[model samples]
Target chain A: MTNNSSGSRFGFLIPVIYIVFLLLPIYWLVNMSFKTNSEILGQLTLWPTNPTLRNYTVIFTDPAWYNGYINSIIYVVMNTVISVLVALPAAYAFSRYRFLGDKHLFFWLLTNRMAPPAVFALPFFQLYSAFGLIDTHIAVAIAHCLFNVPLAVWILEGFMSGVPKEIDETAYIDGYSFPRFFVKIFMPLIASGIGVAAFFCFMFSWVELLIARTLTTTDAKPIAATMTRTVSASGMDWGVLAAAGVLTIIPGALVIYFVRNYIAKGFALGRV
Target chain B: MSFSWMAWTLPTAIFFITIFALIAALGVWEYFSPGGGPRVGILRFETTRGDRLFVSLLGSAFIHLAWLGLGGPSLWWALALSVVYAIGVFRFV
Candidate 1:
């Protein structure tokens, strides 16, 4: 009994320590966002001595700053929605069908995701420019889809496969058409999987900087890109940058919170 | 002004429109046909489409990471290696 209790206590300590380690960067960002640049340069403190909302004030007041957030949210949402929608059918195809070159095709799709975003950034810019797509939220959204779609398909496929084949057969016997069955029966069964996939898609698109930066100049600049502009002739606005970073983390944190229960299974790709 | 979408650039507008179009197309395709058959692949285990996708994606990530870690002037080589790796994954993994 004593051994088990000690082992449990040790396990608790491990996660507690891990959580603190993970939170350190975030805590520092929040901490710095409240401090003046002079104070930030002057000392290292656990918390700000004179917490100020000045950093946030700059972000909220500046159209350039706040617009970046809006642009980012726009593309991120568009990308997530597009990725999941497209991936649903593709994932279903992967989970259930075997067409010619199906394996090769699926693999090829994933390889697109593996290619460095930098490699595609220039090409994406050129392609979008040819179509006159520069500085658009959609340009970033579509560019991000290159990565997010495959990931969504891969994640959702795992969840879809876990579902028993018998369910489809039974629904068919009940005379439910494929579309109806898929919408009413199959979708609900895989609701958690969809949530998990959407969460990942949102996170990936939100944090992605290379393609987002390359694809947009100003009209649709992402918060990540906007934050980089803080470094000017004068110097870095560390406080404002830290505040932007804090704001950037909020969307991802909110997503993880909403899908907290399914995240473990999502990470496992539904294998667990 | 009630949320002036006119402030958005042409490319941004097009990009969004394209996404909606793609989604609509996919929906149409799914409605017209159904997918749910399994097949044996080059892999030892009988894998459906999803399994191969998972393996390929997982493999591709490693391949890119490895290529990056090896330190090269251009990622073009990484892209080439990834294609080969992807083919191999589809054919055998």
Candidate 2:
């Protein structure tokens, strides 16, 4: 137990350092959000002499800023829902069955995850334009799918493999239908995997800027795109820009807080 | 047929198709043939499954670059294909 104290101290050191590094940018943004333009430019005040919520008011009263948040939420959640659903059956199949072209197909699905958003920006725009889905929520959702689906399938497949195969056979022998078996038994087994996959899907789509901005212009524009509008003839609105950047972190942080416990082991899809 | 209607895009299309076909064939060969053990190290790294996964993903990264450089798919496609190839190793290999 003597080493326990040092081990605990070492452990605290990493997380404490990580917390400070992670929070510094966030703290600066919050500080900027409470200050006026003159204050932000005049000096680097640790505490604002006259803290005002003017930037907050600008964000709320501004239709563009407020609506961007709504659009982003709508598209990201749609992406999450679609990605998780498609992955479920595909993963179950890959784990449970020995089928034709299975390996080739699975790899093809996964390559979508590694793609750089910038390169896809052009082709996706053209592809969506041809399909007449360019400015819609569905376009963003589908574009996101090109990344989210493979991950969902890969992670969920690993989780499915961890489950015992006999479970499936037993249900069938007991006169349970495939649908009944999956709903009652298989689902509960993979619930943790599902949670992990949803978080990933949400995170990728939530933070992504290039494709989301390129594909949508007016009605469906994301907050990332709206963040671009914080420019004027004189210069940029640093306060509002920082505030928007701060706002972007809110959803991702909440999600990680919920999934942080399961994230690491879940990466292997339950293998480790 | 009008000149515009029957434009000759097939040559370029065929070039891309041939490259992809070759990569696919190599994947098939990798899976069907034996001796797929990881070549390098960590604490331990020498199994058919581990090598297949590593080679497949690594090969995929190259394939995507090739796809981008010599061919015309977007980076999103490359990213998407990386996932697809990783899954393929799991299911097939």
True contacts kept of each: 0.00, 0.00
Candidate 2 on B1-93: residue-level lDDT in tens? 123422459876795686578567656765686344334333254445534655666778797888888877577787687778777765555
User: What does candidate 1's lDDT look like per residue over A1-272, in tens digits?
Assistant: 33666555467778789999999988989999999998999988889999999999998998988999899999999999999999998999899986645665787789988999877876677778877889988888988898899999998899899988999999999999999999999988788899988988998899999888998888999988888876573388899889988998897788888788766655565554
Q: List ranges where model 1 is wrong by over 4 Å.
A: A1-8, A261-272, B1-93
lDDT of 1 by residue, B34-61 (tens): 3523567565567644455556556767
Over the stretch A1-272, how does candidate 2's per-residue lDDT look in tens digits?
33666655468778789999988877988888788889999978997789887777888898988999999999999999999998999999999985545665786787778888888898777777777787899899999998999998998898898899998999999999998999898987788898888998998899888999999998999998888755653277887777777788887888889887667656555554
Report the Cα lDDT for residue A110, model 1: 91
Winner by lDDT: 1
Q: Compare the candidates by TM-score and give the number of the best one.
A: 2
In model 1 chain B, which range of ten residues has the least summed lDDT?
A: B29-38
Off by over 4 Å in 2: A1-9, A232-234, A257-272, B1-8, B16-93
C-alpha-based local distance difference test score of model 1 = 0.82
TM-score of candidate 1 relative to the true fold: 0.72
Q: What DockQ does predicted model 2 obtain?
A: 0.08
